[model samples]
Target chain A: MDMDMSKNMERVMKDKQEGLEEWSTIIKPKTSVWNLYIKEIWAYRDLLILFVKRDIITVYKQTVLGPIWFFVQPILTTLVYIFVFGGIAGISTGGIPKPLFYLSGIILWNYFADCFTLTSDTFIKNQNIFGKVYFPRLILPLSIVVSGLIKLAIQFTLFIAFYVYYYFQSGIAPNYSAILILPYLLLLMAGLGLGFGLIFSSLTTKYRDLKFLIVFGVQLFMYATPIIYPMSSIGVTAKEILFYNPLTHIIEAFKYGFIGEGEFNGLGLVYSGVVTFIVLTSGILLFNRTEKSFMDTV
Target chain B: MSKVVLKIENLSKRYRLGEVGSGTISHDLNRFWAKLRGKEDPLSQVGQVNDRTAESISDYVWALKDINFELREGEILGVIGKNGAGKSTLLKLISKITSPTTGSIKAKGRIASLLEVGTGMHPEMTARENIYLNGAILGMTKSEIKKKFDEIIEFAGVGLYVDTPVKRFSSGMRVRLGFAVAAFLEPEILIVDEVLAVGDIEFQKKAIGKMKDVSSNSGRTVLFVSHNMSSIKTLCDSGLVMSNGTVSFKGDIDSSIQYYLGNSKNLNSFKSYENLDEKPGSKDVDLLEYKLIDKEGEVIDSFNLYEEVSVQMKFHIKKLNGKIYPNIHVLDKYENYFLVDTIPENEIPKETGIFISTFKFPKYIFNTGEYSIGLAVTSFPGSIVHFFENPAIIFNVTEDDLSLRIGPSTGMLPGVTRMQLQTKTLKI
Candidate 1:
């Protein structure tokens, strides 16, 4: 053992002329804001995938229903919206069936809500692992985004079942061309949620008051979006104010595509896309600045 | 002359002592304004010079300060220190758990930290799933974990319950599984902080052996922080002693331990009370002098590892009410009582007298450490103590050259004593 160690040392000493850049990792006092470490994120994609798997498989472990809770949550929320907004409040669904109208909006809205609330808690919840190991800190919030997508996919099936039922019974037709934009709509929602979540998670590390504001804030923000009520049913002033909320356009487009009702515009989708890009970029910048030293405050 | 794989330069970490909340935002704003004006961070000046004796503690502390060290490939360096000596802080900085306030920790290849086992484990997940999950968290690819999956399970000795949820496993099994995942991490540099302090002894031995194997076979560097001196002494190639946020000593394993132990604040090795009124004793008995002497009757402040030394305590018994049992208590530096030797019954005094009670230690008795003696006189039954002086005099037992003679003094000699046991050995 001694001889082997000595030989290794001798070889290392002989290579002392190697430049400083030969070191694989160089931890410095400050990391520049521009270097987002996107490649490192790709390198640890396996961990990100496994994290998403953990969130999905272990969410309801030991419970009899398991992932059935995923479908139940959106189904229950859709029923409540149909009763309170469609039946009691006499809100117009733009002639679309109540279940189909509510299910589409609820599924899209739930995805954003879940992603925002959970991603916002990234730092505080995963400080244990973050403090112990060095992986792309971005993986945590990304996993939340991906897991949210998985849930949306499962709930999308339930929404499709309602859409198919309504279509066969009443011969209602969805704009197939508008439905093709679903993938892009899903991306916008994830971007908005992840962007907002990262900013909050980073801020909450130092000041935890933002943590308590999240659940309440997300609920209030949902009311501002065109989820329960159709964009055409509300007053023009109300619709104009709600349009400023980027989620309004995304959810409206989602409703238009599947139910062939609610508001949809190319310019509005473009505006939401730009807002998501800004929020996600700024969020990534804030997250990058925070991940390096958040453990101290956290 | 081995190539250094890890080099740290001027590494310093300043921590906010109290609530790092909105109250500090004002300070941060002040620092930001100063930095904008090409001035140094105002908060950075707080810990530059530690006024340890100041009347009030500062709101910021330097958890580590200007630490500089280098680790060669395949070198296992043990970091030992008292709590709050910046040992864990050093590990934290190296692992990038928290960024340094100022400095750089440059290293070759991947640096993996086992700061704690099962760091990201979800209790509801099964062992098989946790293996992949934890391995991935530790930076192993799925295919890599699958490749070493069987080896990890075999090493952990938990093959029977691979599919069982981790919550069902005992705490020991959980630790074992966690350690197993980390053991196969195979990073260029591994930072382990007291992970071995848990788990059973057999597993600890296995882990220790595995570390030695990993370093020697793969030429990987490992930085281990543990309070267990024996483990450090046995496993590390060199040692670093930390004290009060700085490197106090860096040398071979044995001398580093010596420096840490001898650094204990015990200025005087002999204590004597010349004035009768100020003696450390009860009214009946007063201690005159407490000191250590060798077999040649020469006074010495420190004892050699293989030297025959005696602790002699002289006291004046003004008045005796019952049989007095003069005893000497030997304690390690941390005040852990090792042994107490009382005078034989026949040697006990029955009346008032000026008596010198001596307790002798045979050669090669004490291991290397700082020790102190407690003098007391108690009655035999129920040990009624009349007068006692705890830690009356402090002395150190330091090591000498191996030529002094021994059976075999290898990497470490644990325990407070090195007593020689006699036995008859033939074919057996």
Candidate 2:
């Protein structure tokens, strides 16, 4: 063992000297922002699936309701909103039944809200592992969004059940026009949530003051979004103000697609979709830059 | 020549060392001023002497200064340093977890780091789910993870609990599962920092073995940071010794080890002797200071396979009641609790004030490592009236032929006892 180590040690010493000289002369530290974000993240798709699965399982684990909590949370929250906003406050639902009315907005909104809240603080929460490892940072928020989708799926099943029951009771159903736009609406909601969430995640890495802002801001944002009352219920001036909130078109379109009673304008939907695209693109760019050096700030 | 896979050049990192939020406003103002001056940064003052006590001294200090190195494919690089050294900071920079304040790094292949096992394992997620999640965070494809899924679970040894949520798993189990996923990951460049510090002894060994296999078998480059010199000698082919935020030595593991052990050994005795004063000594006398130095009058940081070092001692005799003999004892650095003591009874004296003694190792046949020296004054029979235990006059031994032969993965032999032996083979 001694003889072998000595020989190896000599070779290593020679190599180290040569390596240092070579490194000093030829190496240039440059980061490929685009390649790193898209390619590296694409490779780690398996981990994302695991993260998504972990999110879904852990949320329900040890609870008596298990996976049923996914269904129950949206159902219960929607029922409360119906009592408070629909029955007591006399908020209009654009002629859709209150349970169906609130459940559609609540389920879709829940997915976006959860994605935003989880992804907004990605670096702060994952600082322990992030400091120690080298992997694509975007994978953290990407996995959160993916995992949120799984929960959204579970809740959507309950929404379908409620829709079917209401359909039989009223002898009315979602028109073909509404059914065709369901996938698009889902994508829009995810894109917006992911974009905004990543923007905050990047900012929170440095300031940390943004964390409180995000938590409180999201709560107030819930009111601005057409989740509780349909867009049609608001007067003309108030409707114009709500139209400026990009989430308004998203939720309004989702309700209109499901219940066939809420307002949906092409110009508004296009404007919101464009906003989602820009937000997501900028978010990705910021997240890419932030992930590289959040260790120093966070 | 082997392929060079990773290169770092002129890398320097500046860190604000005190009061996290206090520097924010100053940093922003500096940034604004720099922009006004059309310069990159306003605070680029170099060689401004570090008056650590003064308020005018900038909070910023270079965490790393002109660090440069390269690694061949399949080579395991051991980064060794004391606390506040730039070892972890180097890893962070290479991993892109943080950017360098100045300089650049170029790596040829995909890198995966076990910076910490289970970085983002959601407590609510099952082990099975967490494995996937952690894998993704590590940049492994689903198919890649699936292929290794069974192997990972088996390696973690968690068995049927793979499907259970990770929060339910014990800390050890969580670590095991996390390590299993990370170790199974096959990236082109693998970086690990003191991760083997976790789990039981057996698991640590297993983790080290896995790291070795990853680097050796797959031709992957590995960068490992650790304070355990023995482990560095056992696991790394090359070494980078960092001191005070600079690459003090870089080369063959032996030379780097020699440089590190040498620089640190001299300081040990001073600290130990200073600390020894805190322990109340005999009423009559006190052992104030102790140290070890070499033939050239240099403090012996370490030794060769067969070398000599001198243990020098000094003390003050407040008032001597009777005759007392001085004794010198030696211990391995890792095991300073016990010692081998030799008394100079014949040289005893009834003292009044200052005293000094020197013990020599004419042929200090110790392995290349760290050893501690202790000093004491004893009465005629056996009772030690005053002593400074492990008063750290330390040294390391280096033998080029011997270290290379031991190879990587040998357990870190912690002391000098490995030195006091000889081996021979006789044919029957």
Candidate 3:
């Protein structure tokens, strides 16, 4: 009986040894920080697209207006800005039409705001799904970015309608530089939103106080940027303070390119680009670090 | 020899107790500084064992400690433990939903986990849309989901409500849809955690059948964690039993279950009621000892179908104005009562100081299985229970030569009792 038991044990041991030899994945407490594993994210692109679709389709499902709310939100916000900041507050738009000028800034700002808020709350909002399955965590934030872009596209058409009206009536032609720098401006805004959002999302897992702060902080941040008023209208001291804000250059450059009347400093744009790169790199590092263990705290 | 699909070595997870976000930054910084100075983490050494009921000495506790296991290809491993025994934590770690604080796990092929059903299903989305969404969340590609979409809907039996919003469906329907998507997930390694408990009996049976098909036919590895012993015994080839955040036993299914049930205090088959004061009973009558004895009058917990057994109960009655009958209720492991035998009031003695009553069961009366006995003393033809002790004793009945004569039975038998029938062949 003892010999038979030993033989059984030896056979089991041999099977285990053979099993170990064919192992394909090594899971550990920590993975190399430098190994971003972008290929894994690529493989999950279909899931990312589906998530984006779900967000876009379900956001206003119960509302009567449905997808029309996407158009109504930007239009209503633009009218309020036109009246409150342009007409009532008497904020100058650098000789540009109030509706067109504010609409342009509103569309871009809405996209960035949506991306930032959604991405920053990724860990908290999607903890249920994240805690139950294994996927590239980056897909969640990426889906938000993509959905935000789709919203921007819908809102951008409204801005173009206003731009065309003013362009023919008031002879306001978009400068060549604006068309050339449009892609760069969009990239910068996306980078800044995604980067800062990921950082806050990672931090919020440990410190829940950031959740409340992010909602109010995003509003306060909008006022700091030259979204309501043109950069050319501010005083020298105020301009210097606003210049330090990375978004100031993107908004100002956007107005200068499209409407042909806002401050567009080459150095300021370069500074914003560099800051976006830094924020994005650090955000990704922090996000990756937090994704592995966020469920423990969440 | 089969290939190894997953291997975990020295894996451990530590969690902060009490508060969610208390002093994590300081602890993180302190660990960083200690590591920089070439020392161990100051906090790692202070964590206590994971005992939810006890007062923790430190704010940190190890949820899972030094867990190690390996799975060969096509093997179904059943993980069983009491609540808070780190069963879910082990599944989470294997699923990559959470990482360990120390050690490593090496695995091959795609690993999909169903920690819960309807994980990413949106209430506003239609059943069809949720299928795609939930499928993607489980790591299935769009084409893969599209290929199995009809089958998933058919299996869930929600084809009539395909276009309706998920919120309109019943909870069972939602779970069926969610489970259908997960069931169709053809990952190389599948991890399931108590999800089979959802839905009705028919749905559960279907889901269990699907899981069996997935593992047996596809030659895939499956890790199942459940409190349901019957399902675990039916579906798993090997078993892993965890206790106090560590592995207690790992072996073939029968022995692992034996060790797990043996170690569990509440589920032990042999229970002696030595302390009469602790046993629940009225002051008039108290139970002293209750046990299952064989034909030889020896106390035993296990028996064969051919062996006659008796349930003996010793009691001390202070005063008895009326005749009291001794009753024993026999319930299966699933808490389904099979029989209730009560002694006649005339048979019981009216004047009793210390009395012993034994209820004998003839051979071949009970089928081979585990049974629990609840003891009670009550007045005959009256609805009053004077002294009652629920689940006072537990025992198991195994198949002997007499039972094997009927035929070989693999799973649970069809009826409650196995009776011998006499037959004669008539030649025309």
Interface RMSD of each: 1.2, 4.6, 1.5
Show the lowest summed lDDT stretch of 10 residues, model 3 chain A.
A16-25
The DockQ of each candidate is 0.59, 0.31, 0.57
Best by DockQ: 1
Q: B209, model 3: CA deviation in Å?
A: 0.7
Task: Write the residue-wise lDDT of candidate 3 on A139-179 in tens digits.
Answer: 99999999999888888888888888898999986788567
lDDT of 3 by residue, B34-54 (tens): 999999878764446787888
Candidate 1 per-residue lDDT over residues A1-298, each given as its tens digit = 9999999887676675654447789999898977988989998999999999999998888889988998888888888988899889988888888888888878888899888889889999888888788888999999999998998888888877887788889878678899899899999999999999999988999889998899899988878987777788888899779878999988888777777787788888999999999999999999999998998888
Q: Please give the clash total of every predicted structure, in order.
A: 3, 24, 3
lDDT of 2 at B310: 74
Worst lDDT 10-window in candidate 1 chain B: B47-56
For candidate 2, write residues A157-190 as lDDT tens digits. Answer: 8988988898889855566686687777778888
**Second chain only: TM-score per model?**
0.63, 0.63, 0.63
Give the residue spans of candidate 2 off by over 4 A: A1-36, B20-26, B29-33, B47-56, B122-130, B149-174, B266-428
C-alpha lDDT values of all predictions: 0.85, 0.75, 0.86
Real contacts recovered, all predictions: 0.89, 0.59, 0.87
Q: TM-score, each model?
A: 0.77, 0.72, 0.77
